[model samples]
Target chain A: MSYSSQAIAKPYFTVAITLFAVQVLFGLIIGMQYVAINIEGIMFDTARLIHTNLLIIWLLFGFMGASYYIVPEEAEQELYNPKLAIQSLWLFLALTIITVLGYLLLPYATFAKITGNQFFPTMGREYLEQPTIIKLGIFAVLCAFTYNISMTILHGRKTIINLLLLTGIAGSTIVFIFAFYNSSNLVVAKYYRWWLIHFWFEGTWELIMEAILAYIIFKVTGNREIVEKWLYIIVAVTLTTVILGIGHHYYWIGVPEYWQWIGTLFSVFELLPFFFMLLFVFNVVNCTKCHSSNKALKLWALSTPIMAFLGAGVLGFLHTLAPINYYSHGTQITSAHGHLAFYSTYVMIVLAIISYTMPILQNNINNRIVQKLEILAFWLMTVSMSFMVLFIAVAGIMQVYIQRATDLALPFIEIQNSMMILYWLRGAGGLVFFIGVIIYIIGFFYNRHLAVD
Target chain B: MKILTKPKYIYYSSLIIFICLLLGLTIHTIIVLPERDHRDNLTPQIIQGKMVWEENNCIGCHTLLGEGAYFAPELGNIYKRRGGSHGGAYFIKAWLKAMPTNIPGRRQMPQFNLTDEELHALIAFLKWTSEINTSSWPPSEKG
Candidate 1:
């Protein structure tokens, strides 16, 4: 908010939250379809594609918004090019809209053909399904974004946080080049895909998350030395553990058997950074004399590390071992882990930053009513998502037992039918989550007439 | 304060240890592990079949080698299940040709209306996939 260029982040944050609401709506639809059984026309796969794609796109939007806001402040400069940032935002939103509409309207194959996927043929493979042209467009956008941020850093203070964030952004962009490497060899294809997925999430994204969290803690506690020291340790652990953690996905893919041992042993260490994050946040909060009146931000800041530990750290360990994963692979257990991990780690961090920055950007302390509603939204979203995680974990455990563990194994459909009640419960949780999102959005516009603090 | 003021060597050494461990493990996984023999012999038809699978977005519904969606049964071992004792590619082709049984009140796969050539290629792809070492995944043929 110190720089006029930072205001460009406002549109990105607004759109990100809006898409988050849309993602939750799709979650409810898919959750309902799980139990209803008779709901037709919209296949579970179709809903799932939308759900997963929106999750990725919206999170990207959130990250970009965060970069726009954080990079300038850390660099002590205006954005390198605010106009380019705005253009990138619009282009990204437009492409996302067109891509989503295509997914909904046309058969995936026809859509692929229409998007010139036949030329390179990188359509199906999970999460990297965007057409080759769109992928190129994304690459272009990322280059522009990286250039803008990097130039600003070059012109101004090059703090560790900025350097780390830049490394993450640049590293992820480079890793994405492998998305186009859709070899016919599934093993080779999966190997490259993890270079994008695992490296981004566990490797680079952790650096980005840590940098941002460090920024927030510094702002709150004015403890630069302590925060920066923790940041270094966290990044070190992350780089060490997550690089090898990619082996976990290699275990079941057509890779060699050694990945079984390597994946499990390395993945066990992947939880350390998240655990350190929990300690970092709480320690900062405890030592700080200055309690920034933004209780909502403080709440989000605190929730992130704790929830991330439970979701990504503890639950990830539960299935990281090869023996357990053999049964849990591709089951709802992964889904449960995924839901909590992304929510706690990535989603909460984004929301936390937005909550902290939005008030400053508006040049006001939020009115009491707005603050109260925002806190309410926080509880509603966090509690309901936790419930969603619990219900899905229970569903996953039951599925593993009945479908894989038991002497008399059940068919997938029969087991799915037996888990209808849990699906219903999950759907209920989704409904509550949707309500929380709506409340969170409404809190933004409420009390607009009140005077600024 | 003492913890924060500790010499930088401890931190640097910890980082060094981490990098060494990661590099060692990565090399073991990528190079030391021998390649499965079947992978070195992929034919043009099998490659084409994999393209067909990707183009059609079959992974949206089916799990291949315990990857992809779990909405449908795992197809990584479909050849073993359909072929029974002797793994034949014919059953897979037949099954693909006769999809979307449109059964009442059950999940159904939409028919892609693949050409004969595409079907052949897809079956070949499945056959090749079945032969690759997946570390004995899917737990059983029930997948």
Candidate 2:
């Protein structure tokens, strides 16, 4: 490794992979619950809380690992504070364990009361449901992270990729302060929730995801100018669409009349960024002589754009227009979009960066068994998740037809009852997905054992 | 040539322009929220009800404003559908009281054991929610 501190990424990746396994297990439980397959202990809500919370936390770990690994090489220096980085990792992980236990053991309401939700009023809004204390702890963890990364960047050489990554980390951190805002008006509360959520997904998160992808492309192809050029274009296009296109969400949320037209016109263009990402990855890889001997670099690198285009671009556009979203806003269609878009863009990008850098960290570029397993894991997870999204989307379309659009309107319960079969297929897909994640985690450990031998 | 040679400058400038536009739109959106969301109707009981809603984690199972887990039916307009516009408070109270209907296989709701005061307050909050202009959502009362 170029820098001794790069080894810190190993532990972050290890923790992220472990939590990802836990997340998929919860996902399996929730999927089964949807089809009445008998989760005796955990309720759907509780399982969902664990599943989504773990997903967000683990993905954050992935980002931290990516930054820890990438920033040093880009800067040509050791990390600013590797010790503090390790401490923050442990601190954040420990707090997460306690918070999750609180979710499982305590009555959520009582837990909220004791954790000062009454004062902050930020508990139980999907994804931002952590108690005020834990949210504050998370803020502290992110602040430490931002400080470390910012100092590292300031002290060393700067590039567009590094600068964009910093802006993302800092911008998202700043917007998170908005989550503590509480509004008695449900409309306004929902409104700003998007401010926190959409900005992360489309704005800050997009920047981070693309910048990392740029780093990967440079690693694989040794085309710094091309990578930077594509990254700059993608970021500019993404921000315009992401910032203005938030109107798509505003359409149904009691916002305003103008958003229907405004949201539609802008959100439709959200496709451009993903399309460009797909095109950029292919053009860079295909046109350049790939410099890496890591057999799997191509797999991780190419798969992200292909899936991002399919999941985030095509599938997202399927329901992004105001007319279609009016019918499918909260249905399984949105769930389907969420699963694929998130898995394809954020989740896959994290895995891409992890797979790309982890080999360098170990100083072993070619591990045959690990490469095979990664491919197996890749195909299994992507195929099963694709099927999962398909089933969920079909269920959503059926729901719209039977419940909303059809003249013979069925009640919500009956519509759900009629859609049991799709839920069963979705459950089966979740099982496969869970297996893929488990296999992915086991592949890493198996490599470590071989390294020791 | 500039697109290739100096893409970074274009990137930063375009971001600034769009961000300014977003800020302007956000201000306009805020100025209109009070009228659209009916801020005058946010009574103490309604606000208290909102707190109770958060405390109970109602959004964990049910969607208010179509923004939560989809485990339960949409309740943003529950006041209109179940409360019959005039008697929404009573219907909501009774519904909250009845839990775990023991339907053999159906997903059961946990009884929150809310007091009468909490129940009334929750209903008031929902009533306020229902009156907000959603520009026609759920497409039908089936939500």
Candidate 3:
């Protein structure tokens, strides 16, 4: 909130939390559908489309907001073209709303026809299902965002954190351009799709997270040099592991068989950064005199790396081996990994940044009640998501055993039927997670009137 | 004592080594491993079938190449299972036409009302996909 440009992030963060709540709602719908509740007209597939797309969009918003907030502060300058920033935000939000409504209201095929998907035909590719027009819109918005942030950095001081963040944003934008390159060859299409997905999450986004975590560590501990050095090491390790780790997705795709060995070897080391992140956070926190009064922010920063390691690192490792992934691929195990990895790595980090910055925007003098609510929300969400992951993992294991492992292989439907209890448990977990998100939103708005008064 | 006190060189060298290793791996994956013959031999019908699959959002329910929703069985190997020794392209074509068996209490696939041409193309695409080297996936034909 130091510069007027930083205020642009407030709306973005608000929108992010709002979409997050919507995502959880859709997640609950899908969860219910998992347990045999059939809502008329709204298929589980449709709910899934909404849920996954919203998750990606909301996280993009979070990342954009975080960049807007962090870049100005780290670079020690006002944003370049705050007006353009706000305009792009609105356009992005509008497009998201329109796209989501289309997904909900129209049948998938009908929606595809109306969206002019026949021209480019990039629908139904997991997570890249946005119409060509919408994809173009996203590209346009990201280019504008990159320009704004790049200009700000160029005009001001350049630090390791700012440089790393810019690299991430730029790298992701460049990789995303390939989303338009949908080839007829399924192998080629799947190969390039991972260029966006794996490169974003495991590759560039990790750099962004590292930069943000470093910024937070510096803010809290006032140890710039130590944070920078650690960030360098972390980035080095990340580059070493993640670039080759893209092979993990290649193992089951129509790629060559050599990917089995390459994928396993590299993906095994993908856990190092998360593990390093956990260590880095704890080391910084332990050494610091605790400058920030926001204990909730500290809690978030601490938990992010820990949960990231457990979710993205441990759970990811459990199935990353090509042999095990052979059985677990496309099962509930994948869902379990996805849930924990995204929540721990992306969701938690975004909330951590929001937790740190929101109070500054509001100029809250006393945030005791808000802090307590946030902590409660944090624990509730973390515990519930963990339970969700556990339930899904058990279900996935059962599926692997019953459907894939034994000589008496059961059909997919029979296994799914036997896993109804786990789905119900997962649905209950989703309910708790939604409640936690509601509490988080409440915490954001709490005492705002008092602050204004 | 000086080396221990200032490890900047070590850090920089490690980073350089890591980047080189990454570049090496990327080149290997991009240039070496992908099967050129299969990619080159993809037919127009198979390409159209892939487009049809994308347009219809089939991956929304079915897993293909171990990607996509797990609600339905994996279709990456469906051609092998349905059109291999025991079955043929006719079986797959019939299966698509007869979807949504509505077998009470089972997950049902929506009938997309695909044209005969579209069905033929889709079967061709699945057959093409089945021939690609998936590094031994699905664990069994049960996929």
Candidate 4:
């Protein structure tokens, strides 16, 4: 009942840590599958969908936990109810379990029945075979999360940042609902599906980025005024960017002709919030005169916002233009952007929160060592993931060039087969990133006994 | 005493720079948009072909003048892209008439069963699209 240091943060920490590990591990398997012919007797085609989907689910869970921990702090009140929070968590957990089980059980059989004309082992089926029910389950879970977060925010104090956060969550809810209707009709459904995916990427996720960056800035600098200013800038810029930035996804789809111009124009502006975020965080860190904290911790906290901005913002800019994206859409190049921008901004923010809170819970060890290790892990993983994305993008570009050069149609399989070198380089990058994840995981648990008072 | 740590000027300056960049980019795009080009001689065949294309949803599967779904290749310059007019009206007519050809592992294009007259009209529609001044999309003849 007390809002003191005795509050149990261990469970949240445990969930975050476990999800991070699972994400990194699956990420590595997906990476290796790119290069290796037969890893665990599964095709790369089937493995990748699972890998990306799993990464998205786990990361979303981590983000939810981070938000749950922070909203109460910002409000200067205990969570509206810990029981409700736990209830939300259980619903998400149940839904995820059911979905995964269905994916493993029903999907393979369906794939075999449809394509292979026979039954096969359940665990070995292609990912696309999963029933539409799994998608429905995911939508339900998203609704539950939206309701919990909305109710919590309603009862708690409302700041600009929290309100923006609520908006992002609300947008996510709408997008999820839209996603459920995606298979009803191909023409309208395809447009709406892009609305969910593209809007989530270019719109609501932009707001989510702002909220995370604001929280990180507040924790690190203790300058609420500065944080608030940047938050406004981020939200304003992101809204403008996403509303039109959606044109980027529209280019390939059978959308209206004018969307190409609109998407390209807005995407260019999307870089603005990112640039502001970088300037804001670095300026804050530079102005700080205190050295009482670990240099490693300080650096990690200082760098998270900036990196998120770069990963999602600058790298995202590389192929978003209509001219370049016309060639690169649905290729490995787009995948590269998603890998870096999504992981860097969202994943780092979650970890940054974990780094901040676990210490407050128990400061029995030196902060510097943990901070240093965390920073080290951050760079190691980020660089590797960046390499994986870039290599694949280049390969994709090369494939497109070669493919279009021939008047005769080339097989998609042949294109994939020829890009073995790029795949290996990508796999190598994943391995390096996994190594970093292991380092971070070790540092996380070790800090339990090792924080300084 | 307190140390004068806050740089009010720098924050304001940073804000100014961001605003300038936005205005600059928007203006640049407007300036770079290609001037609209018009074609003379409104032929009946071309008009009829365009009607055929629209009614059959050719734009759903193919891009022409960079103004359609990209599910298929850009046919805006297909006359030159195929290294001959071989892929023009006659070739397109045949292709649409017997699409999907039972080719395994290839995306099947739908057969519209357009009459010879309609096929010729659709071909004329595509040829007309190819003739439009698009300032060179796909960046190559083969595209």
Task: Please provide, for model 2 over A410-435, each residue's C-alpha lDDT reduced to its tens digit, 9 standing for 90 to 100.
Answer: 87767788889999999999998988
Worst 10 residues of 2 chain B by lDDT: B1-10
lDDT of 3 by residue, A1-453 (tens): 678799888899999999999999999988888877788898878888999999999999999999999999989999989999999999999999988998899888888899898888777799988888999999999999999999999999888899889988998899898889887778778888888888998888888888888888888899988788788778878877887788788877765677788889988898899888888989888987888888899899988999999999999987899888988999989999999999998999999999888888778843898999899999999999999999999999999999889998987877898998998999999999999999998988674444552
lDDT of each residue in A368-387, candidate 1, tens digit only: 77788889988998999899
Q: Lowest-lDDT window of 10 residues in candidate 3 chain A?
A: A444-453
* DockQ-superior candidate, 2 or 4: 2
Once fitted onto the true fold, the runs of candidate 1 whose alpha carbons sit more than 4 angstroms away are A37-40, A447-453, B1-34, B84-88
TM-score of each: 0.94, 0.97, 0.95, 0.71
Relative to the true structure, how large is the alpha-carbon lDDT of every model? 0.82, 0.86, 0.86, 0.60
The alpha-carbon deviation from the true structure for residue A33 of candidate 1, after best TM-score superposition, in angstroms, is 2.0
Off by over 4 Å in 3: A447-453, B1-37, B83-86
- Cα error, residue A421 of model 2, in Å, equals 0.7
Superior candidate under TM-score, 2 versus 3: 2
Better of 2 and 4 by lDDT: 2
**What does candidate 4's lDDT look like per residue over A91-166, in tens digits?**
6667555644443444333433343322211112112223345556566766766776677678768765677777
DockQ, per model, reads 0.50, 0.74, 0.54, 0.05
Error of 2 at A374 (Å): 1.2
* DockQ of candidate 4 (2 decimals): 0.05
Interface RMSD of 4: 12.4
